[model samples]
Target chain A: MPLPRRLVLTAALAFPALARARDTIPPEARPVPARLLPVPGTVSPELQRLIAAPYPVGWNVTPTDAAGWRQVQVASSAAIEPHMAALAASLRVRVEPSSIAGVPVFIVTPETLPAANRDRLLLHLHGGGYVLYPGLVGVGEAMLMASHGGFSCVSVDYRMPPDHPFPAALNDAIAVWRALTAERDPRRMAIFGSSAGGGLTLATLLRARQDDLPFPAAIAPGTPWCDLTDAGDSLRANAYVDNVLVAPTGWLGGAARLYAAERDLADPLISPIFGDFTGFPPAILTSGTRDLLLSDTVRAHRKLRRAGVTAALQVFEGQSHAQFISPGVPETAEAFGEIAGFLGRHLA
Target chain B: MPLPRRLVLTAALAFPALARARDTIPPEARPVPARLLPVPGTVSPELQRLIAAPYPVGWNVTPTDAAGWRQVQVASSAAIEPHMAALAASLRVRVEPSSIAGVPVFIVTPETLPAANRDRLLLHLHGGGYVLYPGLVGVGEAMLMASHGGFSCVSVDYRMPPDHPFPAALNDAIAVWRALTAERDPRRMAIFGSSAGGGLTLATLLRARQDDLPFPAAIAPGTPWCDLTDAGDSLRANAYVDNVLVAPTGWLGGAARLYAAERDLADPLISPIFGDFTGFPPAILTSGTRDLLLSDTVRAHRKLRRAGVTAALQVFEGQSHAQFISPGVPETAEAFGEIAGFLGRHLA
Candidate 1:
């Protein structure tokens, strides 16, 4: 069961998360602030409330093995079930289970789609650190975007670990993308997602570029997990400052390992930040001052811009990871508005 | 010598540095690390050396009054004189003292200016928290840009505080801008600066927009102090973390008061972030992860983009305020290269 010497070195390089120093930890060891801080009055009351909330107790929970991951996934699906009906009803978005190229997806349609966006379709990749939020649970963000952006969506319920890992989710995403782009005019389509979904979105484009497939009109990868390895500064600087992903060594790192499996984490599809962004579509990235992936999102935007692609980035005042997905918040509305507007400009 | 009630209220609003909470202070209260951290190996050795250096001993030194500020100015000039000669010599840039429309300026020309940039000129405004670097001392950055960017620069030696405050600096910048634009095609010109100089650059554009004058083709405002008021989140979030401007209540706030005099800090002419960015030229902004003015730079970029202007923003990893200006650093080269490329794209 022992790994070969070369494999060990590659594994070491792949999971540098273990080798990362605790330098991001504030030398003065004070407890993380429990209050809305740095700048409180500047943000909305709703955001203030959201910012003050502590990290979920089990945020860093790690499953012992494949079976444990399945249990966590099932539990997550169940927990998210109750909110599904309510969110769909309030947002006036209908989520229909569907399949594209044999890949499971949730076709999210706004009750009142704008005539302007009638021909527009957004490919959605739902976020859950590549392990959680499978099935209908992953459709929440897609639903929100559909409702707010007034565009129909195909939310990929991509395969995840415990059952299928590494190329499974990306394969599902590519399959859906390939199927959709085949029938639809790629100019009228865009790919969008948050966190892992965001990572998948970029990976999809990188694959499309590699396959010489026509690129989507645009992309919105919100606080993407662009780099799987512990390569970014914010991973440390925003460590405990980001309440959502409290630290890099927590569940996120474990999820990354579970997802990558035996593959090298630096593989472009695994960590798209290492991928070349040349000839990629215009992108609008979102993160927050307090987001753990702020560095990932900004770095990706910089890379894209450096590649001569127009990339717009918006960092919310006090938001943590994917806090813009919180419904009824002004910041959420603004974030979605920016994304929708940016996508609209590029899409036919 | 008691101030009037109205003045006191305005002063309170103008200088909220005292009222700011210490929420950004890491709860653990660990001493700031002396080593390069968070992501040590990510940056160049030059940047690592620069970032690890502690804040200048008198970075927060507050002059008691007009005479004290004058004394500080003289000291700053003397100290900077040595670097001026060395930098100019090394950069292969010729700095000539000149006057534009009665305003003192430094015409920084490269030893070998590229033929393509013969007609292109960059109007530079030097950064010194609006109270330091005066006369020829303010032209070092201009020299770097001239040599590295292959563009001639006219660095405005704008009037400063104690004797000439508030409108005087803005007036000098505007006067020079008007005089230059009157002769040169506005399309061939760009305005660029860092920190307080950046604030002035934005204010000048806002003024031009107000007066129905033409705007420069492009701008590069590096880590601008866009808001004179304590309105930004980074002012608190990056407090002691930004070694350059360690805290909001230091000499920065004092300088703000000295610059504004009796003016409201929220005035668009003072805090240009408060100004409308409609019809502005393309802009490129730069900042650092650890910059106190990071929020300022990002906020300005957002505002400009929101106003339908083409704005590109580049934030360096693990850097403090204006560290991009450090000569012989890869980051410095990268930052200037981005600005130069962006400006070239916009300029004739």
Candidate 2:
């Protein structure tokens, strides 16, 4: 056949695929590379919507004092409690408030035990940038564990920054653990959490070992903020690219500073990544590619491997900063399901 | 009540939580961080086994010269065709050889006719650093589109280095498009590929525009080898952390050099990221944090948007080069399905 003519369709439609004809497409026609677009025909319409769902921009207005921080916590808790209740109810779990050694806690228990592992327990810590969520919003991870792992769960209502700060949350966790261990077999239990809760989970283990408390059967720290110091590579490499936690120097940095106050950030309790991890119980870690803590999680996994601990990491695609919390997202179920499955095999 | 001991069992657990004897747990007993552990009592005995499943390490003994590269291609093609055949049968797609304008291609068509839109086509380019994965091995990406997207697919079995380097692949794609566009509506067609295929898919769009051909409706370039010059950040940031394509300075770099021959890598046809995306069709990009070309893919998406193209990005966690191609991965299905969905809406 004779060579087909060039420039026919491009010239006809004036499609801007031509760089040499830069003037063809106007500047305003260009849109910001929005994080995720709801493109049709690629995935199911429902998934397209889900993938394109925007994360609430969590811009922290640094609270100057305890009262201001308390106000922030109250407002956040009120908005999230209802959602947590709905999630728990859907998972067929009951939420009841109680006190352990005078510290308030939320108890999450399945309505009916599976007749086999009724005595097993999981302690959960919720993630909210260390100062955001309190009370019920802090129980999402606990609810998942109780609902899916066939174990009763409890979450500590830990004191947070701008008020109690560093040692407070850690102390609260220690107290609750001390109370639980009074009767519960540590070997039959597991502790897990996400975000700040994830960091707290690692710190709790360190403190527990320091106090000579028995180790839990296993732990799942979902994208643990192990290095509160922002020493991870992704902190710079993924800045702005990770729409969530856009910059560690902003809210994430603020939260870390507020929590640490006069304390050393490198303190193992604050940044567990620097802590001693040998002989630690088997651990499972989870995180997303866009999560600013991607390096933190990966580094933690690497450290765990170095320490010869049995660790399993389950990372989901297109996720950011605990995107697993959305009950509607399949990745959420996949993450929690994997955690439950890992816990099932590891828990005493 | 009396000041209770620090270690007490929860009334529910009835097991002891101990503290106070800090000396019992020696400091030396605790090591550094750990990795995925088989935590007892967490998951079923079976799932723990599944979660711990090891990836078959893909070790490539890359050939040094043109003839060696050709031999490697034959060996790899022979090894992978049976697997691809099994996958095609499962997807109910018939894969057979066809020629368009003297270019050899693989036609992958769904067995059943959908009531609507059966005339639409997806042109797939397969990936293998430029000189590898010839013949059926190059058709993996095409298979995914045909199976999941319900589209009649055709993969360009483009020429590679050692025999037909550089513009051979791009030219072959252009020739095929020219022939196909003679009979088919350009807007009814879409193109995609991964790695080298991803790069070629992009170059095809650039060259097609240069030839002034009508634009395809959409394209999905998965973890594209956009910058053949190794300019992207992840190439360094990810380094050995990415087990696949471990170091670009090694085989990946070698392949790029061979493919380009004497051409400038900055040439839009070689590294399409440098191309002006002014009027390109709406596009979707996919990659993972662990993929060394992650920056390449991300940067390309950014450029397309800056050039005024409608583009979407989906990043996976803990994945390597085109890790989404695993036949058993739900993420693979999810990724391909989304691409098909996007094309469906954009295609005529």
C-alpha lDDT of candidate 1 relative to the true structure: 0.77
Give lDDT: candidate 2, residue B335. Answer: 67
Scored against the true structure, residue B297 in model 1 reaches a CA lDDT of 85
True contacts kept of 2: 0.00
Q: Residue by residue across B1-348, what tens digits does model 2's lDDT show?
A: 111122111100000011111224322111111122221122223222222222212333444677655655564454455566676777688899999899999998888746455889888887887777667767766777777778888888888888788889899999998988999998899888888778888999999988989889999898889888767656644544344565555556767888999999889999988888889999988776557777687668757755767776665545556766655456567667767777888998
> Alpha carbon lDDT of residue A51, candidate 2?
31
- DockQ metric for all predictions: 0.09, 0.03
Q: Superposing every Cα of model 2 onto the true structure, what RMSD results?
A: 19.4
Report the Cα lDDT for residue B219, model 1: 92
Quote the lDDT for B209 in model 2.
86
Task: Give candidate 2's chain B TM-score.
Answer: 0.83
Where in model 1 is the C-alpha error above 4 Å?
A1-36, A71-79, A209-212, B1-39, B74-79, B112-116, B210-212
**lDDT tens readout by residue for model 2, A214-310:** 8889999988988887666556444443434555655568778889989999999999989998988888887755567876886677577557677
